[model samples]
Target: MGKIIISENVTLDGVVEDPTGDEGSVSWFTRIGDADRAAWAEVEHEEAVGAAALLMGRRTHAYFLHRGWASRTDEWADRLRALPKYVVSSSAVADAGWGEATVLAGDVVKEVAKLKEEVTGEIVVYGSGKLVPALLEHDLADELRLMIYPFVVGTGARLFPETSAVKPARLIGARPVGTALALLTYELVHP
Candidate 1:
């Protein structure tokens, strides 16, 4: 069975929203130096290469599509372009411009449970802020890989919101990737 991994770029305060500052919100993504960004990128690339598939919410998918990730020829973009993608959205995707994607619009828990059984390796979730809490609540997420930036965005969408149920996890790995980033890996401990 595939492990559903929540891979998120987070601030020290646990905010997951507007990491790139594209939304005109507080962002720590661009504050890091070039070397730090490069290191972070390397870690992300490695994760992308190792993942079996990419999973995202509708808005996250749209965000990437809007950024034109589909047309980029870089290695990272190539990896993303070739990976199998799944989108969880109630509405029909007008265009999966990134590539072919399986849309799960039914019961979130049931659809994800079915997906977990169908694949092997890691099904990595990125920037699915709205979908993550549900995944955690349903115990659908098997692991969490957080790329933590040094600073904090005082108020924003968080990977784990205050309203979410407490989900226990044991840290499996923690390492400083560069001057300003830390890579923390944890495995969900189901009761």
Candidate 2:
């Protein structure tokens, strides 16, 4: 069965809203060098290549599709573009401009469960802030692989919601990708 893996770049304070600093997002990652960037890219490539498919929230899907990856000629970019992308949204997607991307076949939870039954690899989730909450709510997420930068954002949408319910997760592994980046892996546990 496929494992639902949530992969994201977050701040030390758990903010996943915007890491690219498009709207003054606080992140020390802007100081990363070529070596560190390349190291991170290699990790991303491995994960992307291993996944059976990608699940993205509508907003993330729209933003990314608008960016247009088809013009990129790099091997890693090619691999990323070729992977089947399932956008999770209630409304119909007008068009998935990104290569090989489509609106999920059915309801998010049901379709995700169906995907797990049909595939034996990982079902990777990327940049889906809104979808992550649903995954947690429906007990669908299996693993979390967050690349946390060594900085704090005072405000923004956090990966985890601020509700009273306490979700339990265990640290599975940690990899330091650069001078300040921590690739933290966690497994969600039901109690």
TM-score of each model, in listed order: 0.95, 0.88
- Output the worst ten-in-a-row residue range by lDDT, candidate 2: 93-102
Give the best candidate by lDDT: 1
In model 2, what lDDT does residue 187 have? 99
Off by over 4 Å in 1: 94-97, 163-165
Per-residue alpha-carbon lDDT of candidate 2 for residues 32-147, written as tens digits (9 for 90 to 100): 77777888888898898888888888888777766666556777778777787788877766454457566775777898778778768888998888788878877788999999
Per-candidate Cα lDDT values, in order, are: 0.88, 0.80
- Tens digits of lDDT, candidate 1, 1-191: 99999999998889999887899898678899999989988998899899999888999998988888878788998898888888999987645457788899998899999999998999999999888988898889999999988886798877886644578999999999988789999999887
Highest-scoring model, TM-score: 1
What lDDT is obtained when candidate 2 is compared to the true structure? 0.80
Measured over all alpha carbons after superposition, the RMSD of each candidate to the real structure, in angstroms, is 1.4, 2.2
